[model samples]
Each structure stands twice: as C-alpha cells, then as structure tokens.
Target: MADPTDLNLPEEREHVYKQQNDDVPASSLNSTPSSSWWSSLLAASGLVSPLDFAFVLFSVVYIFFLGKFAFPPQSDDPSKDPPVFKAEGIMVKTGPAFGAVLGLALPIAYIFHGVLEGDQEGIEAAVPHVFLLASQAFMDGVAYSDRFSTPIRVFMPVFFSAKKIFTLMDWVGNEFSKVCVGGGCDAAAERRVLLGRGLAVANLVFWSLDLFC
Candidate 1:
C-alpha cells in the first residue's frame, strides 16, 4: 500500500550500495600488510648500491689489517721513530680541506648529477674512485692513531694514492669517451660532459703528483 515516490527507493538503494562499497573486504586488508612490509624491505635494500657494500667491507678489512699486523707489541713503543713529515699552519689547514673537496664533495656531486641525468656510465666510472678515496681516508685515520708507527702512517697514504691513480685513469678515459661521442649532445649535456672530463683529468693530475712527489 506504499506509494513508490514516497518510499524514495532510488535514494535508499544508493545509500545501501555506497555502504557496501565502503566496507573493506577482510581478504584485501589482510593481504596488504605482508605485501607492503615486504615491498618496503625490498625498497630499502635497493637503495644501498654494491659500491657502498664494498666500501664497508674494505673498511672492515683495512681496520682488521691495522689491528692485527700494523700494531706493535704492547711493550714496544710505536711512537719511538720521528714523524716522517710534519705539517704546520697553512698546510695542516688547507691540506685536509682540499682533500675533502676532491675526495668527498666532487665525486659525490658527480655521482648525484649522473643519477639525475640517467648517466649510468658516468656513475660507474666515478663510483670506484669515490669508495677508494673514502677507504683511503678511513685508513689514514686509523694510521694516525697512536697504535700505528710512523712508517705505517706514511705508507697508508702513499699506497692508497698509488692505487687511486689507476682509478683516476679509468675515470678520465670514460669521461673523455663520453665527451667525444659521435652524435652531438645538448648544451647542458655537453657542459656536464666537459666538466666531468675536466674534473677527472684534474684528479688524475693531483693524485699522480701526490703519489710521486
């Protein structure tokens, strides 16, 4: 006996339909938790590159080597020998600053820029030198500790710098190839290529001089 218009059936049906749609299915809710957690874990793992892992491994080995072999007997004074080369004033201040810029800042900037530009070759070329330089810095710190002798302190830099020269050579070659590629690139790309080449050459020169001089 109810009038269809008075019943407002369309509106009532729409409200019911919306309520059904709004109710989340238990299976969907249950499925998302495990999948999301796994996805987050994978994302985190992907962020750490192989170079980073290598750097960490190298640091551990380098430190272990220093502790096990580089260290002198407890009775023997490690500091008995005179310091190999002492830095005073400007050399002490500017030396570390220059090293930090070349080793840490420049490579990091180049790596980030390469990532943004999708330059995989450039990134690959720069990464080895970055990690090697970082490892050198780590070993240098370890060498400076009182447990190591003067000779060990001197040896660390000389050895690492020699290794770094080879890395720089590879980097320079990679950048040079990029710059000279047959098809011409855009202005921004050209500028980046030139800058990268120049930086690589500069590092090559600097490290060569550091190792030999």
Candidate 2:
C-alpha cells in the first residue's frame, strides 16, 4: 500500500536511488560515510589499515622515483655548477627506504653493541698512529717555514696555516671524542647502538604482546 517512491526503508531507499540515478548528483550515491570520516577509521587500524598503508606505500614509491628518476639523473650530472654531494643526495632522496632498513638494523646493532666493544679497541689503538702521521705532515710544514731566524716567525706561520692547523686539530679532536682513558677509548658508540636496538626491540615486542590484551 505504500507509495512506490516512499523510500523510508532500505529496500525502498535503494529502489528510489536507482530510479533517481540519472537525476541524482554523484555525491548522493550509496556514499554513506564521508571521505574524511572513512579515512580516519581506516587510519585507526594498524599497518593493516588501507589508508595508512597506501600513504606509506605511495611515499616510498615517490622516494624510489626520486632516486631512480630525479636525483641521479640530475644531481649526478657533472655539469651541475657545484656537483651535488652524492651521499647527501642519495640520503635525502632515499630517506624512507633507508629509514626502514635502519629501523630493523638499529635493534640488531644495539643487541650486539656491547659484544662488539672489543672491536673498537683495535680501532681506538689506531688513533695515536693517525695523530702521529698527521703531525708528521704538520711538523714538516713548520720545519719548511723556518726561513727566518725568529722562532715566532716559523711557529706563527705554521699555526696560521689554516690547512695544517685544521689537519692537526681534527686528529686530536676526533681521538678525544672517543672517550678514551690514556690509550684506550670507552664503548660509547657500542653502548649507544646497543641501547637503541634493545629499546626498539623491547617496544616492538611489548606492542605485539599488548595487542592480545
């Protein structure tokens, strides 16, 4: 007995919608949820969420595009005024891909950092040799600058030589930054790597466990 156009119920609504398909605006279709609302709902889900997945996926694709298509083609060109620092260019363009790699590597690095502490001793012991080598070049410059009888003349010229002074200071500063006592350095790098990996793995495991609760 109800009017054919009476679209109060679901069936009637669909019928009316179909009837008005030509006349109805595209926005009035079975589009119940608004786009923004739907997107938020999808985003609320984990990495399984389509919206979040698509965003990350597209972003990664864009990075690949930049690296493969944009950056190397343009930046690596020898014709560029000042050649782009290839390492920095690659880093910026491939950041997302690199980040994902680093994320996994970070945890592993941390777990093994303390174990690798002894490896740095060999590396640290080589520092004094580096300094000694660097000093030889610098002292040679000082000796060569000894044209004047005035000792200050030789000393000042060597000290003021930006390249020579920088070389010596760089070696000394780098060695001290390693946190060595006398001839040995601390495990600072290893400790940091270990802490990062441990925390990352801990958080990831905790999050997975919490999901069941």
Candidate 3:
C-alpha cells in the first residue's frame, strides 16, 4: 500500500493550483474585450498613420511646453497685451471653415481615394503635408488662446507655414511625375493627376500668402 501522506500530496497540490487561479481578478482574465474595443476605435478614427499620430503628439507636448515655460502665470506685459493680428467679421466666420476643408476634409478624401486606387505614392506624398497642417492647426488654436503672448501666437503659423513649403514641393513633384503609359492616360488617371496637382498648388499658394502676407 502507498503511504497515506503520499496519497494526500497530489490532492494538496491540486488544491493549491486551484487557489492560485481563483485569486486572479475576473477583469484580468477578461481583458480581451477591453483591448478589442480600443483596437476597433482606433481603426474607426483613421489614426493608423504613425506620422500623423507623431505630429499630433508633438503638438500636444509643444502646447504643454508653451504653457509651462513661454507663458507662465504672471502679470501680463503692457507691450504683449494686444494681439499682432486680429480677424475681422467675414474672416472670423470663413477662416475656420476654410481651414477645416483644407486641413481635414481635403486630406482625408485624398488619402481615402489613394487607398482605393492603390496609389501608394500619392498617399505617402500627401501624408506629411496633411500631418503638418493638422498639427499646425492645433498649435494655432493654442497660440490664439489667452494663455500665450502676441509673439508666440504669430510664431505658430509663420513657423508651420514655412515648414510646409518643403512638403508641398514634394507633393507637387509626386503629382507631376504621375505619367501615362504608352502615351495614353485614362480619364480617371488624368482626373486624379489634375486634382492632385491642383490641391498641391492651392496649398502652396495659400501657405505662401499666409507666411508673407
């Protein structure tokens, strides 16, 4: 016959294993749903572009830096009291709508179209400019806020607009390089090229005016 202690050893080990499992929280065991929900949300939000995400993150950090160092809690200087430029009636209404179309709607549509057409080059070309534009918009809002001074407010657009020129050049070059095979381009391809070039040129003109005028 086996010793009684040896017989009990197996049962004790089984009991200890079950106890360890029981000690874990239910939420930890069921974490799949939480992670799945986040994944679904991210997919729906069109934030899959790492470049876009990085720019957005940078904008946030820059805002925090401006608030902490550039505009600390203190009495406002008389010289920095007035804003450098203020929008008037019609501009106040149209400015944001124009920005929304240029920065958000146009880029999303272009990107989606590129994805559908399997135009990877077009998508890559557009991403940097759109990402920078989006970040610039965010920074513009922060700069316009009461927390910052006139110089800081003016600096945001000037800096971003200047930087965007280089990206816009790349975009224009990509659009222009899209050529037809066998000296015959389909209507769809022609249309895409026109639209791409038009959009790139428009941005170039707009931002140049924004920087200099």
Candidate 4:
C-alpha cells in the first residue's frame, strides 16, 4: 500500500475545499428564515394586491346579498307586498340604468352607422369597448335592482345575465380572435350568428320573466 502521507493529500484537500466554498451559494449558508418565508412567498406570488383582495371581498359580499335578498318568500295573500327597499337618492336608481342604456346605444349606433356606411372596419373597431362598458353598467343595474320598484325584480337577473352573455360574446369575438381567426371563416360566422341568437334569447327571457312572474 502507498503511504497516504506522500499523496499530496493536504494541498489537494485545501484546493478542493477552496473550490467547493467558491462554488457554493451564499444564500445556502442562511436559509430564508421561517418567520418571514410565508410573507415573502405571498409577496412574490402577488397574492396580496390591494385591487385583487378588494374585488374578492366585494364579490363575496355581493353574492351574499344576492342569496339573501333576490328570491322573496311566496305568500297566498294578494294584499302582501313583495319587499320594500329604499336608497338615498334618485341618482342611485337613474344613474346605472341610464348608463346601461347609453352603453348599449353607443355600440349599437356605431354598428348601425357602419352598416349604413358600409364601413365594416369601423364597426368592428368600436363594438367591443361598447359591450364592455355596457356589461359594467348592467352589473350596476343589478346592484341597484331592489331600488327600482316599478319594473320589479323578475327581469333584473335575466337582463343582467343577458349582459353577461353579451360581454362574454364580445370577449370571444374580440379578445379570442386568435382562436377563431378573427371571424374570417365558417366557424367564426357561426359564432357571430350564435351570439346574435343568444342576444335574442336573452331579450326573450327578460321579457318573459317580466310578463309571467
């Protein structure tokens, strides 16, 4: 057996140790402290943004209100009123409704103007933004549903859901153009026809809900 002492062992060991130390990262020396790791991870994940959390809380509260108040109790008495609700001002009732009508009007006018002028390009450019604003206004309309006493609540959800469908179709037509090739083919044409049909159905549903119940 060779003598271990004569193998240049100490210098090689020192060189190896130096190289290993050089290669090792400084972060490995002190791990992320347990106390702050969760917070750091949350910050890095963007799980605590103000807007995100605000919307989350708002959605929860909004749904809670929906479940609590939307469907009223049935009673045998004709004299019994459904439910009474009041808001601070007429502005509350008028604002969102007017906004919805205007939002709907702008895009519709744009599209019609384009049709009349044979400017398909212009109509294509403007309609999606109109649908988005209309959706927001529709949501506002729902948020104030109880405030409007004359029309009643039966049509509210149907209208709101129609707005939702409109918004979704707009997104599919505009944002997901890559998926459908910007309505250039048969499939895209089908989608547009489907959207028109859906809008018609939504209108029917709202009117039906208003008339019967």
Ranking by TM-score: 1, 3, 4, 2
| Sliding window of 10 residues with minimal summed lDDT for model 1 | 3-12
- Clash count per candidate: 0, 3, 0, 0
Off by over 4 Å in 4: 1-73, 76-85, 121-213
Considering lDDT, where higher is better, how would the candidates rank from best to worst? Answer: 1, 3, 4, 2
Candidate 4 scores a C-alpha RMSD against the true structure in Å of 27.3
Candidate 2 residue lDDT tens string, 58-164: 53344345444444323232121221123334433443233223322332233245347644433332222222222222232222221212232223222323322
> Which ranges in model 1 have alpha carbons more than 4 Å from their true place?
1-81, 89-93, 179-183
Residue 53 of model 2 has an lDDT of 40
Query: How far off is residue 110 in model 4, in Å?
Result: 1.4
> In model 2, which range of ten residues has the least summed lDDT?
4-13
Clashing pairs in 3: none
Inter-residue clash pairs, candidate 1: none
Candidate lDDT (C-alpha), each: 0.57, 0.31, 0.56, 0.36
Give the distance in Å from residue 61's predicted Cα in candidate 1 to where it truly belongs. Answer: 4.8
Per-residue lDDT of model 3, residues 1-213, tens digit only: 211111111011122222346575422332233223322333445643675556456656776686678765354531224333333445433544465466445865887798898877887788677666655554554454446555555566666777788878888888888785335778786787788888888877776765676
Q: Candidates 3 and 4: which is better by TM-score?
A: 3
